[model samples]
Target: MSGLPPFAAPMPLDAAAPAALETTRKAPTSAWYALAVLIIATVLGSIDKVILTLLTEPIRQTLSLTDTQIGLLQGAGIVLFTGIATLPLGWLSDRYDRRVVLAACVVLWSAATAMRGTAMDYGVLFVASVGLGVGEAGLTPITNSMIPDLFPRAQRVLANAVFALSAIFGSALGALLGGTIVHLTDDLRPWLPVSMQQLEAWRLTFFVLAAAGIPVVLLVLSIRRTPRVGVPAAKPGAPAAVATGATTLRAHLREHWRTFAGLVIGVGLTSVGLSSLGTWLPIVTARTYGITPVQMGQGMGLAFLCGTVAGGLLGVGAMRYLQPRMGPAAALRLIMLCNFTAALLSTLLLFTRSANHNFMLLGLLVVPLIGSAVLLPNVLQDAAPAHLRARTIAMLTMASLPFGVVGPLVVGMLSDALKSVPNGLAVAIVATTLVGGALGAMVLRATEGPFVRLMRAAQPT
Candidate 1:
């Protein structure tokens, strides 16, 4: 707030002038440091979310949970609550300091994660999952809102990519770490306090992971506040007006509902494939290949790493090739391609006979999946008015909630239904991906022109 730059007034789309595609201003060292911290934070959040996936079999066996219950825990329990909390949290991010908001979120989710360790039944675990969902909901909107302010327009894609890559790393790290913890629980038990020594390996794993959030909270608080770029300055002696901003955003959405509808629904459909893959791939592989949890974790972890590296390179290359020709619409084009590619690759699972080969294919499939993740935030940030940025992101989350929630649950039900058939889980995954990809592609194709116009309209004259 101290280095307060002059804020720009909002102009109607028809009256706005086209601005240059790039800026000469370089982001400061502090911005890069902040990004580094953000990377760590993202990684921590992802680990918390993904650890459940790796531990699913053990948890199901321990709690006497059915596949449907596991699906609800993975899909609806977390995704549903997260969607419920996103709008209010997004409003808070817009109205208050993001660092404080994000820090509080970390604490809440970390505590919820710790609570998972103490669950003795499906009901208790479901409650913990709800808490975890609500806490983690703030992360996407707050982080997306912050990145635009932290770096100039030209550098945003790279910054967003870096942040997105952290998630991939976290997934990998979670697999490696979670698997190692589960594998070594027996040896680790002797070092624990007497009371904790009797706890299950999965429970102890949660406790250890929950403690990791403390440092992340401190790091979040350390981030310096950055000015909200493109926001109009409040009148000299008046409080910033939230009602006006909300009204303006609602009007904008109403006027361009088709574009937003396509974007929200398309992204949601795309998430179905990814969500199902993440939730069931490890468990299915373990069951089909007769591998230990640690082996599955290690293989999956390596796949995540390989995919992250490959995806980052591919994303960068695609952006460079496409942005010059199509500008903001390039992102949508890339995302559509990613969806189709992921769907096609998912079918290959039916043919896979070995664990290593299946994981290797999964790594390749991650390439486009990473591309979509990296660009989606940039798309929302670029298109939404600065004052409504967080809310717009939250809207996407809220709208897409059903897809994320239903995808895994449906896969679980399908797997259960096909239990008598060979490679039934693989068949279920393939079905989900095919439907999601085809529908997502059609919706996104309709959105491309509108998205481009909206991006241009949102730019400063």
Candidate 2:
């Protein structure tokens, strides 16, 4: 506890750090425009993930699938591949035009999502999900890597808050609009070819969401490319390896493993609660109230909308109130504070039988659960060398898989295991939240020294 496990500290990642651009300097017109596009695209990607959550019950009924199978499709089947895919994709983002990379991924995932409608059974659906996962894998790392280069450090929390908020809005839309689409598509089943008249509503919903991504792909294609600010412009004769940090990637990670470990593992643990809740909340709602999926969508969509706003304000407010006064280290501590509360509130969500009470607790859980999403990436961008930004973010993305992949899968297994219990899935969810929160806090506390050291190294001389 006195210090992090031995790892070299070196000058924190960006050795030839670009001059930090001031927000007041030059027109930030293009940066904001590009950010808007990124937000829209990410929303589409988020919808792709949450749509499964919205339709889990119907899919289970249609396919006669068990809760565990549904959970596997939503959790590990998607995120495990996402975790595996990020490494190569991160490398491409580091070396290529990220806008092009992003656009390509958007098209790939959109196509995969549309293909999901054609699945005849669980195996095909799972394979389609794996494709969706791979496509989405390219998004976060590329976007987070690009953000710091576009906005000044002073404004990064706000930028990240906006980014995080868009994901929330997208998930909310998935619930609100996805449910509505499912309801409306019931009429279209009649017009289907005789063989397909029995096609499920969820399949049509997937098609509608897939169509939404097409416009986003066009939007991404139009964004102007920006320079990679993490890497200094190469000297005229310098090798490409030097320009991209490939030669030093291993050495940098070797010495700075503690910094990366603390940030990645700590933040990743907190994601378990978020992942579990996202997958199970709809099922929980239906069981408790007997509400239709459309009604469930309305309640959840509005709650998520409120939670997004609250999360954004907390993330930005923490930076405004803390960073200027106490520095980036303090801002990092603010995330730890949120993590602690999330652990407490998430457990409470399972204790209540009242639908209203559970929803209120969920809103509270999200405030802190999402605060980490807005803050941790800023910390990663600050800690990693510019040339290695995408890979580092990708590393963080992969870290979340342990918990993100397991949380829902375990909840479903637990639900089935304890079916006779009054609220088995709810219990499993709360138990997972408690464990993830506690472990995250411990890592956050343990890694504080490493984080401070890294922040000090990143400071302007």
Candidate 3:
């Protein structure tokens, strides 16, 4: 514990001196600022996602869209941009001011979210989604990288739990608000300055969400900079290469294999279920069960909030408690298993016959979605090295993008085939829960203790 191994005293990763990292500084017993930024950032991501999810049916009905089309608009389109945009942005954060990058990302994503409501055709919507995706991708690396620096060893689990809580709350806010906002905006258009177009309802929804991002972005602007931890000892004369601009696509790929691979299979599959439920469920209910958007969003959103928040709390708390008693791998593995089972419940919930039964199912399903949030971030952070952290997040993000497509596309296909949104959702959710969950679990299995150990060993100690 003598001030960052001999090598960590910050040489130069780029022209920027990098944030003057307090590697040697005692970790804060409490990391409220870090926690606050994460929650704010998660809110930004969640709002956009909720916008996409809630608007799916309205947009589809307005556009005369096919089921597959809805899937593309929500799932595949947004993720594609996110996957591509993250690597460079992530690397840049490693080199420059993360707060700056985060602020920019907020603006970009919010604008994109606002624009989405105005989209007239598939092309415009797709473009907007890509922008939104890329914007959303900006957070994971910087946020994850910041936590270790802020909390150190004693409070890692606590810090992570805080983040998980944000993820759950953010999603709930989006879902809970989406329906209400749409109702309000649609009704109030005549009094507002702008003309309400056919898609005006969704457009208004985006504007409101985008407008809310300002305070957080300003806060990001005001926050003091936190630096990356530790310097590379680097081999002999090879000289450490600090990531400046985005690393080459190939170099990024070389640095991230397992994380990306897991991301692809795991996130992709998760998207299959998540996208279906989050984006399409409202539409499915409205189209099939003859429910209103407000009713559907409120019900499902509440279940998600309850389940995810509970799951996240339990997941983080369990890891915190279990890590010492069991081991890191087992602790994490158990959390993941809980997540897998929760996803199964979410799937089952969507298909239940009785409304009460469906709600019960949804509540059960929230457990895993929430559990995964708690564990996945920590697991990925553990897998990657400081230098590769951003790149790793970006890669895994990219891998997850396709599943966004898969989930929606499958649902769309099923809808077209079955001629019913309910039937389509039932099939889509079930397939993704089983297929995606299995793949995610498979990826989790690959995380075996040693890989994580080496990754941790590589952290600035």
Best by lDDT: 1
Residue 332, candidate 1: alpha-carbon lDDT = 89
Candidate lDDT values, in order: 0.81, 0.75, 0.66
Clashes of 2: 2
- Candidate 3: residue 107 lDDT (0-100): 88
TM-score of each: 0.92, 0.89, 0.82
Encode model 1's per-residue lDDT on 216-323: one tens digit a residue: 999999998665665544555343345332436687678668879998888788778778987887878877777876887899899999998988888878888989
Winner of 2 and 3 under TM-score = 2
Displacement of residue 90 (Cα, Å) in model 3 is 0.9
lDDT value for candidate 2? 0.75
Rank the candidate models, highest lDDT first: 1, 2, 3
| lDDT per residue as tens, model 2, 368-431 | 7576567766676666666777787787677667877887788888888988998887887888
Worst 10 residues of 2 by lDDT: 2-11
Q: State the local distance difference test value for candidate 3.
A: 0.66
